[model samples]
Target: EPEVTQTPSHQVTQMGQEVILRCVPISNHLYFYWYRQILGQKVEFLVSFYNNEISEKSEIFDDQFSVERPDGSNFTLKIRSTKLEDSAMYFCASRDTGRGNTIYFGEGSWLTVV
Candidate 1:
């Protein structure tokens, strides 16, 4: 079976710098999404991409954030300016064309901004 892979497992960046979180979701997945886990807050939705366009996104995904599928198999989230509050565990997920929505998460990429 195939699985998603993130380029960097952990990242530390300075505030005001840019950061790109990458992930290769399961090859057969038709829907892709990015979610985040704040230390003491609920899991939050960031954005969802399908058919090369954004299908849905939360208010959390502001102008500073963008998602793209650079290549057919890779999905990425770019943060224009990193902020300390942006530190969190970013998760990439996708699901195949099935009857039920069973999303699989990548080994989440951790981001730390100082």
Candidate 2:
């Protein structure tokens, strides 16, 4: 069964520092997205990437944040300057071609800011 794998399940970073969260979705889905859950809050969409370009993005995805598919295999989300507000569980997901609009969140990277 294909699944999404995220590196560094947990990460602690100092405020104003840089952090890079990596993920690999082992599927041939056309839509890839990054969603974050801040503590007890609901999961919020950050950005969506398709065809190697950003198809959609939320307000939280500012200039400080960026995502990339370095080699078309691994997807990386970089925070140029980490902020306290950025501390949350960031989930990297993609649409399951086997399923409809249902996305599989097999892996998520947690970020902590001090």
Candidate 3:
């Protein structure tokens, strides 16, 4: 089965640096989302995008974060200024359809900020 794939399963960065986490969503899906889990916390939705525009975004998606579909297959999340609280597992997810559809997660891109 096709699955979402994330790069640099483990990332280490300083407290005030930039980081780009990459993801390749399922080929035939139309919607893309980014979720984050801060250590032992519940999964939190950051943003969702479809058709080249943002569908929804949570408050957690503040000024320092951005998402882009650089091409047909790649979806990327860029953090302009990392913080200690930014240490978390960043997940890339996608759903083929809506209305009771479930999102699938990549193993996760673990970001560690010191």
Candidate 4:
């Protein structure tokens, strides 16, 4: 099976700083997404993108967050002015174009804001 890949497996930054996480979705996948899991909490959806545009976004995705597919293969998530509460494991995900297709998640980029 194909897989999603993320960079900077772990990052530690000061509060109020900026961070950009990168991901490479499965080559054949058309739908991409960003999800985050706080310490021990359940995974929460952040945003989804397709066709070079945002398809949906959760309330958690505020002005501080942005997503982009800069090229054909790379997808990125940027967080501006990070906060302690923003510390979590951000997972990149992708799914093929089909009804109820399985969504595959990356190993995750762990962000630690101090």
- Positional deviation of residue 6's Cα in model 2 after best superposition, in angstroms: 0.7
Q: Over the stretch 5-104, how does candidate 2's per-residue lDDT look in tens digits?
A: 8888999999999999998876677778899999999999999888899999999999999999988678889999999999999999888444457787
The list of candidate 1 runs beyond 4 A from truth reads none
Candidate 3 regions with alpha-carbon error over 4 angstroms: none
**Best by the TM-score measure:** 4
Candidate 2 or 4, higher lDDT? Answer: 4
**What value of lDDT does candidate 4 attain over all alpha carbons?**
0.97
Off by over 4 Å in 2: 96-99
Ranking by lDDT: 4, 3, 1, 2
Each prediction's RMSD to truth: 1.1, 1.7, 0.8, 0.7
**Cand. 2 TM to true fold:** 0.93
> TM-score ranking from best to worst?
4, 3, 1, 2
Top of the candidates by lDDT: 4
The lDDT per prediction is: 0.92, 0.89, 0.95, 0.97
Kindly list the per-residue Cα lDDT of model 4 for residues 30-75, writing each as its tens digit.
Answer: 9999999999999999999999999999999999999999999999
TM-score, every prediction? 0.94, 0.93, 0.97, 0.98
As for candidate 4, its clashing pairs are none
